[model samples]
Target chain A: MSDTGQHSHDHTPRPDQDGPPSYYQAMETAVRELLIEKGVVTAEEVRAAVEAMDARSPAQGARVVARAWSDPKFKARLLKDGSAACAELGIDMGPTHLVVVANGDKLHNVIVCTLCSCYPRFLIGLPPDWYKARAYRSRVVREPRAVLGEFGTEIPDDWEVRVHDSTADMRYMVLPRRPEGTEGWSEEQLAGLVTRDCMIGVTLPKSP
Target chain B: MTARFGPGDRVRVRWAHPPGHIRTPYYVRGKTGVIERICGSFRDPEELAYARDGQPERPLYRVHFDRRTLWPDDQGRAKDGVEVEIFEPWLEPADAAMEGGT
Candidate 1:
């Protein structure tokens, strides 16, 4: 047995965890604790809500996209009412409305929340860090093509690049056009090609 | 609730900026665009932000602004456009909206 207690290692704290919680973080903690103390919500309920949010992933949105590609009826419903269509597939979008925009050979759609980082969290889980950054929020609306180029996506010269600003009550998700050579493919097979970036309209799905 | 502006109706975003939880982007203010579709009525986010019940929901519309109208620079292609969700209160008929006036 080695004498492990003889020496102490001065370990550096994680850079992100070194400082105190941010203003919003502290406010959230205070409010949550007060709510729990007042019996408004239980700790278990809070934990369960967090777990539910974490459980949601890009896979859910991919499934919806795959289904839409396989079924025209679902695609129409998705375009008309994204929230209800998603609910038909058991993905509850909560209160925020979802707006699904389609991409085609002549038109490409990209989504950004200019006011804040509003996203289709229920369908595609939490948004990526870049989506929340001010650079993306401002630049995507001003110069979308350049922003897309930074993501390694190039918009054709003649093609139209439409940007959806998810301001106010609505959230947006881009329904990327199915890639070529995917004919007769099953929904499961198609789902694999639908990436989070594709749904966000930053990049296209890779062909298998 | 009935929508004031229907699809294809040209509308302009009100330029006035009140200090509150406003959802309209600054860039679109005073800019003219065609109403793409009615996005249904929803609670007023301006009031809802203050924990108040936004009584009598307001109609929302998806307004499509051409990139050229919004930005004069050569940023986007000619067909490029940007659509924003604007509450009914922030929009007025394009014909009725004039420079230096409401």
Candidate 2:
């Protein structure tokens, strides 16, 4: 055997020793440490909050909205007032109030937080990585058709595409019209049709 | 905060330019349209991202635009229109309502 560490040829570091810490891990550690030092929040409380937050996914909200689209009575209630309407479906609007816009054959809806990334978190879970990206937020309002076209969505020549601006107090969600092939589908099947981009008004729902 | 504009109200998006600010896509600035709906109020992300949440809530409006108005080059169908959200601050009432009500 060679004298240099048994003549090993590999130079790459081991899994546990390789690479710099991730930004997420670093930020989390820093925030936790600071909180602990300041006594603003305990490590146990932080862990509990993170666990609870993770459990609050957007799937439930999507299901409620999808079911409402299939039910005329619920759709009517949603149109009347989304906050109360969501409650009827057992989905809490929570701290952020939301408005649900229904899209039809002649009318289409698109949502953007022109100033920032104001989104309907309750209905769609976390906004997609792209939604928070500068490329999308900056280009969406100015180039609606182009941006949507990139996502494989094309509004009809005669159909109108409406853009909803999300601001400080108000958040918006698009209730895309049910696709033709999905008739008689169950809520579970229908939920699959609801995409995060669709709810954000970037694309239409796909057939179940 | 209650919505300031209503369905069918005509308004224009105010041109905003901030140093090193990238926001509210440029093509839509100065475009005129009618309000379609009021999406409710929440913490403005622009403020929140800047770590300033003390500001009051701002009203969000859904505004509609004719396709012809947005894209002047006449190649596609004539009746196409687009709707986008605008804050109350970005809009001013237009002289007449379009097909929808204000």
Candidate 3:
């Protein structure tokens, strides 16, 4: 209902380029066949893994953001112990530790996997094509504000841009600041404002 | 595991050229930063690359770097910075000169 007045900006940043396919495909096929022949794993298992990643979406993360915005206690728990907080919220990421970084008056956090596409798939679904692109992986680290500008997010010149390179061992989700004017908005109403890009630190949550 | 550094501690990542998988970003190597928080130790990603269990787990610190030090040519905000998770073995205490860096 509240969504009617505003748009859901998932940012669905389309993939702008193709990956090195032939080399990776050949290597992947060879290794996969060998693994199957050796009985290390089954084709079904591989398919299931893909399916699991596909099953995840931004809504899982949006719920967490909505609750944190309305409930300060939950926000504290989410920031202090992200895994435990998500578990309580029923967003199961299956042991991959999640870290919630908060944006403030002077600082903002953006996520990028520099070495590879290491993401919190259980929480926010597949990495966008742009997310896995060389342009993003390389530029976001060196020039964050510039990359964010491509997404139409203009940060004030005074605020510090803290880019988080999700290299290994942990995954990150930006807890965007709740928009103003909806002082009495419901959690579902608030959830509508939170978008995938907002969680990625490229854009702010749209106002209702 | 005990944390060698905490939030606000100044540190520098050594620019080691490991032959295999590494989680540290190249842009951050040799750059000095302030410790944001200590992400508890886990399997070392380098060892994990070779399929070896990253045992004797290493502490990973969230280090904050100055935007200028990372991209010297950039004309962005002076207060802007970058935060990256770096394993303990790859980092060391920054010299006093580095501690004074923005």
Candidate 4:
């Protein structure tokens, strides 16, 4: 069958200045009004919940994991049991437990939620749109080297690339090894090296 | 369910046709490897992301495949091999064991 040239766009319309409501605005209003009318949830409650959620950030957990990478004992603990180790670093694991896989010279680790976007949300916060996108989920496990290469990581032929499927119950976070140029770096400095791509094992932490 | 494969056991990821939303990566498909470690059972993320709960947890396994096996045509001066995690449902034992088990 020849490929069709059809494209599907689901853009939500934006409101014109002092004009009629946009498509998204209309839908949002309809849903909110329906909820209020049905007495399911109040409009005020929705606004309050959104505001409270916006107040928190994932930086707290990132800092803890970064520090642990610089500390030998903490690194050991992190590998032994990541959830409890994260707590020691002041990061809560919440309802989900996490397992930290360390990437080194011999083994390279990459994580994917084969069934969905089950990430270590307690520590990493919400995953980016790409993390939940179909392209990533379908491509990463099938072509890890290529996908990782697009993210600027080139796995050497000699080093084994291990893709960790984050299916079933456990979540995964990659604790990348400290870069050579970053010796004696402070926790704050080290945190800068911990990018989302690195945590996902698609890229390595940047060196000094 | 218990893992049918274990660390050092060679296996292959069963090919899966992607539809709607899926998390299995595209590169590691059809690659063969030795089981490196068992990462325990958990909820499948594809189902969880879509709020499809009540699905049974499946055992997760980490498989290590040689880089040469993945890219036979490449000529780079570096260590060879790649390790990937596969659910119990995605793997089948290889007909013959390759080197570097465990």
Candidate 4 regions with alpha-carbon error over 4 angstroms: A1-58, B1-6, B9-33, B41-60, B63-102
List, residue by residue over A89-195, the lDDT tens digit for candidate 1: 99989986888999987999999998889999988999999999999999998889999999999989999999999887888999999999999999999999999
lDDT of 4 by residue, A23-43 (tens): 999999999999999999988
CAPRI accuracy category, model 2 = acceptable
Count clashes in each candidate, considering only residues at least 3 apart in sequence or on different chains.
0, 19, 0, 39
Q: Among these predicted structures, which one has the highest lDDT? A: 1
Mark the regions of model 3 whose C-alpha exceeds 4 Å error after superposition.
A1-23, A26-46, B96-102
User: What value of lDDT does candidate 3 attain over all alpha carbons?
Assistant: 0.87
DockQ of 1: 0.84
List model 2's recovered fraction of native interface contacts, to 2 decimals. Answer: 0.56
In the order shown, the chain A TM-scores of the predictions are 0.91, 0.78, 0.82, 0.75
Q: TM-scores, in order shown?
A: 0.93, 0.71, 0.85, 0.63
Best-fitting candidate, measured by TM-score? Answer: 1
The per-residue C-alpha lDDT of model 1 at residue B8 equals 100
Q: Rank by TM-score, highest first.
A: 1, 3, 2, 4
DockQ, in order, for the candidates? Answer: 0.84, 0.38, 0.76, 0.26
Residue-wise lDDT of candidate 1 within B3-37, one digit each (tens)? 99999999989988799888888899999999999
Candidate 2 per-residue C-alpha lDDT over B1-102 given as tens digits, one digit per residue, 9 for 90 to 100:
767778877787765665443334455566677787776554454566667873687676767777566666635455555656566766776664232211
A114-199 per-residue lDDT for model 2 (tens digits): 66688877666677788878888766755667888999998876677666656446678888888878778788888887877788
Ranking by DockQ: 1, 3, 2, 4
